[model samples]
Target: GGRTPRIFKIMIKRVVVINMEEINRFLNGRGSISSNILTGIMVLNILIHNKPSKEHIKVGRVFYTNQGSRSLSGGVEAWQGYFQSIRPTPRKLMINVDLHATAFYESDSLVQLVVKILNKRSVDDLRRIHDRDRTKLEKCLKNLKIFVTHRGE
Candidate 1:
């Protein structure tokens, strides 16, 4: 009755690699910290693949949109091109909105909509969102953290 197939997980170390002083200097001398983090990650990604390393073929990025239900629908066809440009399965990619900043004429519907999305799929992590857009999202994360702690995970 105990016929569970073994699942293998190979862990590779991920690091920023740059010294804190260099990072701080680069970031402080340039633009925002968030922008710097993105740039550094991109550089690491480039470094990770130098030759014909066929291990990882595609990169999965979760794009964030601050706009909720009020975005202009024009030229949305261009998004299809962006989706087609990515090698990974489109299902693996996700876009998350700032739930706190999302405004609707009906507040109840907004909350319900957010909860529905969370139930339908894994909610994207909120650590990278702007500080102003974090209250409701942070509250959700804190509550989930508590629940997970209680569940002994």
Candidate 2:
């Protein structure tokens, strides 16, 4: 008697650009590759959520908990802001976490598999399956929240 919620499969690709000038300035000439990678990952995470623009791409310093050191952090936010400002409609972004990191390593292949799954079924078909498995999705979402919150604290 109840309507089913839609299950949309999402694929995300990220690009990271590091500013050497800003990094050197922030670190005062003391920086490492791990620091840079963590900074990039933070920026990517923020941009995916906020979606900035091109004009705001100038590099600057920002703090990140994961980096544990000073490094470049502000450019991606600026760029995402600029992009969002120009876009006619807001973009919806979703993130999928891979426990095994296999999706990160084999992104293209994993994306193709997702696409294939979606292409094989219509939206209505997915809704029917979701309706049949409502408890499963709800349980998974609940478990995910618990897992993330546990790690956060």
Candidate 3:
């Protein structure tokens, strides 16, 4: 069979360098943190603290609590388990995080969180997600805003 093959072009957009500080300021004000902001900060905190190098982090399944923080189990080792679960995720993929609090208990949230991390995103991307997820994303961004702008010693 000597049929001519048609070539298809696939374009991959280059990821520009993200200035975290500049992004923080543009999304929210310089000061103050609300409950939603707290949630946003928590989300960003997970992304920032888990791995010092961005390359090593994978925003896999993310979990969250609506009212309070997720409870830690089995001491520090749980964090190790947490990271292991999300390791297989690809380098950068945006995710929807309007998951209910119960999903955290089921370990699905970790997967979602990984999706958020690998994608290199801010709350603006939340525009494409569900309304509830967008609300949550906005709040988390607000929270992250406070942390980035703080002038504490």
The best candidate by TM-score is 1
lDDT of 3 by residue, 53-82 (tens): 443322354332234444443110122212
Worst 10 residues of 2 by lDDT: 98-107
Model 2 error, position 53 (Å): 22
Which candidate achieves the best lDDT against the true structure?
A: 3
Candidate 2 on 15-44: residue-level lDDT in tens?
Answer: 656664444444443444466645644665
Q: Is candidate 1 or candidate 3 better by TM-score?
A: 1
Q: What are the models' TM-scores?
A: 0.21, 0.18, 0.16
Model 1 weakest lDDT span, ten residues long: 74-83
Candidate 1 structure quality by residue, lDDT tens digits, 1-153 = 899999999999975464434444544464334554455545644554443144322224222232333432211111110111111122232222221222212223333434442432323532244554456445544533121133345
Cα lDDT for residue 24, candidate 2? 43
In candidate 3, stretches whose alpha carbon ends up further than 4 angstroms from where it belongs are: 1-127, 146-153
Q: What lDDT is obtained when candidate 1 is compared to the true structure?
A: 0.35
Please state the error at residue 12 of candidate 1 in Å: 2.7
